[model samples]
Target: MSLDDRQLLRYSRHILLDEVGIEGQERLCASHALILGAGGLGSPAALYLASAGVGRITLIDDDTVDLTNLQRQIAHTEARVGQRKVESARAAMLQINPEIRIDTLAQRADATRLRELVATADVALDCSDNFATRHALNRACVAHGVPLVSGAALRFAGQVSVFDTRPDAQGERGPCYACLFPEEAPAEEVNCATMGVLAPLVGLVGSLQAVEALKILSQAGNTLRGRLLLIDALDAEFQTVTLQRNPACPVCGHLTAA
Candidate 1:
C-alpha cells in the first residue's frame, strides 16, 4: 500500500523517523486492532492508535462515562457523563484522526464474543479492569495467533506485557499471556472504583500500550514480548521482569496450540 499525499502529511512525523519510515507507516495504516475496555487504559491507547493511522479499531466496553472517569479517561469529557464509554471514546478518536475507521461494541467482553473479535484482529489490547475478562482475551488471542498487548493500573502501580504465540523471525514462539499467569492461578481483582487510581497513572501505562501495539503492527521495534514492565507511580520507578512459559500450561497444551 502506498501513502497518499494526505497520508504522508498526516503521518509526516512517523514517516520521518528512522525506525518508522514510509513502509512502517503504511503497515500501521493497514493494521486492525481490537481494544477491550473503553475505560482508563483503553482511553489513551485507542486515541493514540487512531491518531497513528491504524486502519481499523474495534473497541468493546459496556460501561458508561461517569464523573469519576474525568481523572483518567482522557477520551471522555464531563458533558458525556451519561453516554456509553465507547461513544465518548469514538468521538475523541475521530476528532484526532478523521482518516481512521472505528467500530464500537457497547458490550462486555465475554469469552464467546472475545473469541470472535480476536479471530479477526491483527492485535488485541487487554485494557479491561477485571482478571476474568483479561484471561478470556489472553486465551482468545493465543488461539487466534494474534499479538496481545495487556496493561493494567491501580492505586499507584501498573504493568504491561505482550503475548504473541506467533513465532519470531528465528522461529521462536513467544510466551502467551496464560504462560505467565496460569488460568488456575489466583489473581487480584483491582478496579478504579474501589482502589482509586491516580489520574495520570492510567495515561502513563495506556500510552505505552499504544506504543507497543504500533511496534507490533508495523514490525518495527523490539516489543515487550515475554517480559513484564512494572511501573510504580508513587516511587516513579520502572522495572522489568523476564517471563517464561510453563511447559505444563494447560492453555498452551498440545490440544490448544496457537
Candidate 2:
C-alpha cells in the first residue's frame, strides 16, 4: 500500500533514511506482525509496530490487566485494569495509529493455534514470558519459514535475538530459538511475577525486538539472526554473543533433515 500524503508526513523521519526511503516504509506498511503476549515486552513492541504502520498486528494473550501490571505494562491504564490484555493493547495501539488493523486474541494458544497464526504473519515476535509459549511460537515460525524476533527481560538483564532458518536466505541459515534453548532440556520458568524486574529493562528489550522486526519487514540492516544481545541495565553493560544452531534441536532439527 502506497503511503498517502498524511502517512508520509506521519512517518517522515523514517522516509528520510536512505535505507528506509519511501520503498522501505511502503514495505513496512504492507507487512503483518504477530505479537505473542501483551505484557511488558509486547507492550512497547506492539506500540512501536503500530506507530510504524505495520499494516496488521495480531496480539495473543489470555491474561487480563491487574493492578500489579501498571508498573511496566504501559498499554493498560488504571481504568482498564480488568480488561483483557490484547484488547487493552489494541486500544493503546489504535490511539497511536488508527489507520492500521489490530487483531486481538484473548486466549492461551496451543500448538495448533500457534501454527495457524504464524502461517499468515510476515514476521513473528516472541514476547511471551514462559518457555512453553516461546518454544511453541518458535516451532510454528520454523514450520512456516517466518522470521522470529525473540526477547526477554528479568531483573536488570535482558536479551534479544532473531532466529530465521528460511531456505532462501543468503549465507548460512541461522538457528531457530529452539536451537539455542533446546525444548527437551528442563527450563526454569522465571518471570517478572516471581522474580521482580526493572521497569525499563523490558522496554529496552521490547524496543530492540521492534527494531529487528522492522528491519526484517523492510529488508534493511542485518538482523541479529545468529547473535544474542544481552543488556545489563543495572551496570549499563551490553554484550553480543554468537549463537550456533543445534543440529539435534527437537523443534528445528527436521528442517536440516529435510
Native-to-model Cα distance after best TM-score fit, residue 200 in candidate 1, in Å: 0.7
Candidate 2, residue 230: lDDT: 91
Off by over 4 Å in 1: 255-258
TM-score of each candidate? 0.97, 0.97
lDDT tens digits, residue span 1-258, model 1: 899999999899999998999999999999899999899999999999999999999999999999988988999999999999999999999999988889999988689989998898999999998878888998898788899999989899999999887877776677877788777888777687987989899999999999999999888889999899999999999999998867677776543333
Model 2 residue 223 CA deviation in Å: 0.8
Cα lDDT tens digits for candidate 2, 1-258: 788999999999999999899999999999999999999999999999999999999999999999999999888999999999999999999999999999999999999999999999999999999998898999899999999999999999999999998754444567899888887789888888989999988988999999999999988988998899999999999999999888777777767532
Q: How many residue pairs of model 2 clash at the backbone?
A: 0
Clashing pairs in 1: none
TM-score of 1: 0.97
Worst 10 residues of 1 by lDDT: 249-258
Off by over 4 Å in 2: 168-171, 256-258
